[model samples]
Target chain A: MINWSAFVVVVVVALVAAGVLVTLFSTALRVGDGDAPWRRPVSVGLYVVCGLVVAFGLYLIIPALHAG
Target chain B: MLVVALVIALALFFDFTNGFHDTANAMATPIATGALKPRVAVAIAAVLNLVGAFLSTEVAQTISGGLIREGPGGVQVTPVLILAGLIGAIVWNLVTWLLGLPSSSSHALFGGLIGAVIVGAGIGAIDGGVLVSKILIPAVLAPFTAGLISFIATKIAYSITKKRERDNFKRGQVFTSALVSLAHGTNDAQKTMGVITLALIAGGLQKAGTGPELWVIVVCAVAIAVGTYTGGWRIIKTIGRGITDIEPAQGFAAEVATTATILASTHLGFALSTTQVASGSVIGTGVGRKGASVRWKTAGRIALGWLITIPASAAVGALAAFLAGLGLWGIILDVVLAAAAILVIFLRSRRNRVDHRDFHLPQPGAFVRPKKRKKAVAGG
Candidate 1:
């Protein structure tokens, strides 16, 4: 039997992640150029979050991380 | 032992072609957007591919164990059979590369293997259920899904900021493209590892269901990495500039969508083609942005290439298997013929070379003589 559930889950997760990441990164770029006092901190936070996502993605690829 | 060695060599060569052939998948947009220099982009992709290869063995295991059947009732795939299939794949890959088409290397491999198996060991060797569920299903779905995600993402990105400074988006592209390269390494390099391990198992040097050995992984990684460093500039030109005019923001969106889709598919044990995913995302981003016109003609050509890749490569695989089945002399003849064909393709490519140095120039269309005439006028 095909694991259709896994396939659906992958599709959903990837779509959500791609949407969220693009929005977040683009917003961060917008905020960085704003004149508001809080813009700098908010942009920094978003960049940090993006960095963490990339780091986590890299970590997941390491075989030992998933191995029991 | 000699035949096993030959199979391993061919597998590595396939890996090398896979590396250069698919470099466009991760780095094309970045190069197009000037987010990274051509050479620097390929260098980064090469290193990430090497590092990424060490990250997972799941895909390798899938290739070595799950795709083909073993035992008395199943089709027996010997090392010679594997070699013949690889020759088919390599020939197809080189032909497509010479034509500047970004077809799927994954499909070429699958088609070649399946075709050789049918000719050499009969259709019973294939797991039809796995083929449909795992390989075929994902192949059809992944690109559309990736395209949709990228399309939505690009719209959202443009909506967020109508005209922002591109520097930040270019910076973001560097990261997203790196992620795509890493995901590519995790997926594509493992295919070669799987093929080599399959050959080893067929030769009785390894257990039937085990993952590739450490040495096999290392050699495959190095081969692919070296190939990545070489850069498939022709395909890069096609993906980066031929299909659509891409800005930095669009590049970032496309790369992120591609990375997400490839990683997700890899996690699910689906061997999707990175080339198709990347191409789909590029086209999707093109459609997402208002007033951005995708070169529908070029997209159609790429789609046509994808449609033909499987059956065309399969035909060649079957033919190679038929010829090699004759005897030892036949195997030698196949090798000689394949080598001559490859050399002829290489020499022909020199007549109109596209390299990293001039990849950004307006490329000649498949049937356009005007560009060549213009070039001649300018030279004179």
Candidate 2:
């Protein structure tokens, strides 16, 4: 049982890592352009998307353990 | 058994996408440097990627057998699981591409498998040893090695071509680019072949955990070749221009570094992310050159993505497994979710078409700035 969750957790960690990576890369690229066109909203969109995936995943996956 | 064929096709599709999306990694610097013409360079890379697809199956074997354990159900991997994982990866890739972030498709694939497998077979199914030694270790090391090599190579490339005419140096980049393309084929194309082979074994169409078949090898190669030809221009811009301003010499240095590191890892079945290595090399070369900004914040973002891919995929994978096991409703939800993800990606990509032309004409330092010495050295 531990192993199962562990694997899932590791993969979750990987997903978060990929998300953070994009955020970091974008922040770096967008450095100093205080008014660059369409960058912040784009960054927000990415983060929001990542958040949704993470949240939705938890919502769907966590319930299964109890119901099953 | 038919599912096995389907999985194999999906795997090849992933490989094809990998080839095109990652085309920037292998050929960008060369193209940026004007060493190889865009069309010719892609052709060279495509042929070599096909060749490389045939060169090895150890990594594929590792993925199919070692990374994720199958159930008493006889090494089965549901097509839905594979498809779900692909959706996760594809979505992530598209998002990153739009932002010009050079994230790793290989890691995404690995994470997807880990995700899907965890949900489908339980965590006990994963081989921690394999994921760590085979995937993580290479992930950490390849970029470091590439960066180091690129640092040295950049220094030398500049010294050698220090006084050559600009056009002459550009000419030299062409040959080197071709070499990198060949090397790219060898290193990257084989990954899909491995995935499909794993699918076949899982579906019990072949010996369990065996090497890929000859047909698997051929088709995977062709798919990736075609993908390479199509060009993942968003990545090309992100990798080529965003990391730092890459001059022709820097381009040459980055390509050589990327090629060497990629070829060496593929041979050993380490399954490292070529995107990360290429990005690191490009950034490193940027630092090796004078007055280059490291873009530490962007590097941090990419690092975060690397950190999440496995776990996120696994979480999604686990959910997929649970739902998939739940019977029809689960399948329906899965299908709806997959469709939504695909639609989102398609809509987003349509807005601003990323094409090869992004490579041909740069934005004339649209993103250049002052460099911090310590930060520059760090990315280097």
* lDDT per residue (tens digit) for residues B1-380 in model 1: 77788889889999999999999999999888877888999999999999888886664444424566855666667878888888889889999999889998988887787778789988778888877776677767777888898999899899987473444587899999998888888777888988888788888899987888999999999999998998898899999998898888899999999988877876775546788889999999999988888999998888888888877877778888888899888788878887898899889889999888874443232122354356447645
- The C-alpha lDDT values of all candidates are 0.83, 0.62
What's the chain B TM-score of candidate 1?
0.90
lDDT of 2 by residue, B1-380 (tens): 54455456556667766777778877777767656666777777777666655554334445444566655643456666775566555556655666666667767776776777677766776778877866676667656766776776676655433232222334335644555565566556666766666566656676975666778777877898898887787777667666777776577566656655554444333444678778878877887877777777777776777777667655655565566667667766765675586578768888998776656654464222234334447644
For model 2, state the Cα shift of residue B177 in Å: 2.6
Candidate 2 docks at the CAPRI level of incorrect
User: Against the hidden true structure, what lDDT does model 1 obtain?
Assistant: 0.83
Error of 1 at B217 (Å): 1.8
Q: What is the TM-score of chain B alone in each candidate?
A: 0.90, 0.83
RMSD (CA, Å), candidate 1 to true, equals 7.0
Worst 10 residues of 1 chain B by lDDT: B360-369
Best by lDDT: 1
TM-score of every candidate relative to the true structure: 0.91, 0.72
